[model samples]
Target chain A: MDGLKKHIEEITPITNEEFDYIKTFFKEKKVKKHQYLLQDGDKVTSEYWIVKGIFRAFHIDKDGKEHILQFALENWWFSDYNAFFSQKESNINIVCMDDAEVLCLTLSGREQLASEFHKMEHFFRMKLTSGYSAQQRRIISLLSNNPKKRYEEFASLYPNIMQKIPKKYIAEYLGVSRETLSRLYSTTSRD
Target chain B: MDGLKKHIEEITPITNEEFDYIKTFFKEKKVKKHQYLLQDGDKVTSEYWIVKGIFRAFHIDKDGKEHILQFALENWWFSDYNAFFSQKESNINIVCMDDAEVLCLTLSGREQLASEFHKMEHFFRMKLTSGYSAQQRRIISLLSNNPKKRYEEFASLYPNIMQKIPKKYIAEYLGVSRETLSRLYSTTSRD
Candidate 1:
């Protein structure tokens, strides 16, 4: 797909022949709103690249409280990467928030592609580099106690995601209460 | 250098010749205890692989509270990766907890090695994969309000680090108070 091409090319340029070959490793899947792409305890065999739609990955604690881990939008990659790489059962669930289409690559296929192509490996490494940086930022954010600062940083960093994701989910992601989020939102809008 | 070779081999096996070539990119640096390897606002130019030391990477907030981002022990990689990869000024500081030796590789050197050898690219990707998963686990721990569970999980996952790091820093890492960490340690030891 053109989206896949654009996404891959954002990190490394590929020949038309290479693109055609790389595309073969991915299979397309579709899901409807409220449907689950992955559930806890399932073997995470594949990592996905979103072609369209929004999805949330979360863990439900023992007390039945949902802790949002991350959200993926179009062109973003998503997976229980811990399970995917270790070939273990997933500890989290990913559900489609909007009707979606995704391209999936199994673990073996991913490894094969990376080994067979240097640029592909470069592309994956660069993507992981960015993902690692984001996680580090998230850790710093979670460590900070100021919810308003967290809200402002989240909005500034992901204005598009802020607009697209529901306020309640955003509140969960920020580890803030709905009332606090609403207040922050009102004040942010005023500023 | 043997440690570096072994570290890379843990992910992907490499020939002696390749390992030698790869080792050339890295330069060794020694740091004394309490010495800052990197400071806030300093340009992050290199990522370090610990040879023989413990180090703490942390951010100091406006209220002058230290929030431990991570700890690096022997054979572990450490960096303000967000700043290192982005080539930006660091927002955090990395200080030696023990007199230590580390191998430092610049961004250009790292990129060159990855491009020059597919195995090196695989090596980097695999390391990032593990790092990303650890960050996800940390995010989950941070979101969970139960300090006992957090301490137990951290101790189980990093027993060596638990022994090597000071209790106060561990408390900061868990986002729990030192008093709570002391109780957890006493309970954990009794158990």
Candidate 2:
């Protein structure tokens, strides 16, 4: 769990003993491409921090259209946060987009870390602050940005994920039609 | 700043001396309706916590259209959080919709409180956690919900805000045309 240690250290320093104790709370899992991390109606007991690979958490609407909520790549943390925090059944699904490794931390473990270490609480707070900032940007983009601008913003924001994920999923995430995304992609590629 | 003290104590109790010290870090301001708390291109140095009245933070597009990013009611906190956190110029405007009073806290003040008191750190973290969870739910709603469903969801989720804010602003926030929102409002009222 060097990556986990490194991730935590990125925000705040920890002693060797603290790192070892913290490591005990996380469990590692390997997932194949197309495997589901979570599905609708499942209770979310843990939130995952990506160790490697790609995943998409999405909701399928009544019309059977898949709406992508977010894409998680290496080092990113994700869960159906609504369900995870409230300990309720999820209304969404998380599917591995590529072969992946993730470390899971249960709610109790997370609360324990925060309560046990001030530094850990600060680390988690910093992470949430950044996440909140990003989500605010997303909200404004959804409220105002055009398809071209949205695509450009998404590409610029997550360049690596842009390249790794399929064009169709990008199209869905941007709330644009596949044809529109295709045209934009070709134009972008040409440029 | 009794309200501020109460708000903080709602999460974690503080001693009278601690409350007095904390109050020094916050500056209170009274704003008239239509006055802008923040405008596009202005540097955002502080986050505001509302004590009275309503405000809407928005961006004006190149075509001269205003897109509401969020509405803040009493007890809500807001800013161009991206700019506020990074100490950069803002890309949005926050204008008062009603005569309002807000307490402004700079990044340094926030950090000082967090570092000095574990409970304060926990309080801020809990606020961010709730904000992050709410944003995640918003991302899904924006990606999947139709106009009618969006309006319904918004009303149910914030019935108080729904009553206080005008329908047109609610329409903008929901990303639905005013006409569409009007029809939905009338239908609901008639029912």
Candidate closest to the true structure, highest lDDT: 1
Candidate 1 structure quality by residue, lDDT tens digits, A1-191: 88899889888999889999999999999999999999999999999999999999999887888999888989889899988989999989999999999999999999899989989888888889988888888888778677877887688656768678888899998988999999998998899
Q: Write the per-residue lDDT of candidate 1 for residues B1-191, one digit (tens) a residue.
A: 89889888888899998888888999999999999999999999999999999999898877888888888888898899999999999999999999999999999999899888888888889889889988888888777677887888788667767668787788878877889888988998899
Instruction: Give the residue spans of candidate 2 off by over 4 A.
Output: A182-191, B177-179, B182-191
The candidate that achieves the highest DockQ relative to the unseen native structure: 1
CAPRI grade, predicted model 2: medium
- Model 1 chain B weakest lDDT span, ten residues long: B156-165
**CA lDDT, candidate 2, residue A124:** 88
Residue A3's lDDT within candidate 1 is 89
* Model 1: how far residue B126 lies from native, Å: 1.0
Angstrom error at residue A119, model 1: 1.1
- Write model 2 residue lDDT over B111-168, tens digit each, in one string: 9999998889999998888778777777777878777667766776567676688887
lDDT of 2 by residue, A96-135 (tens): 9999999999999998999899999899889888888888
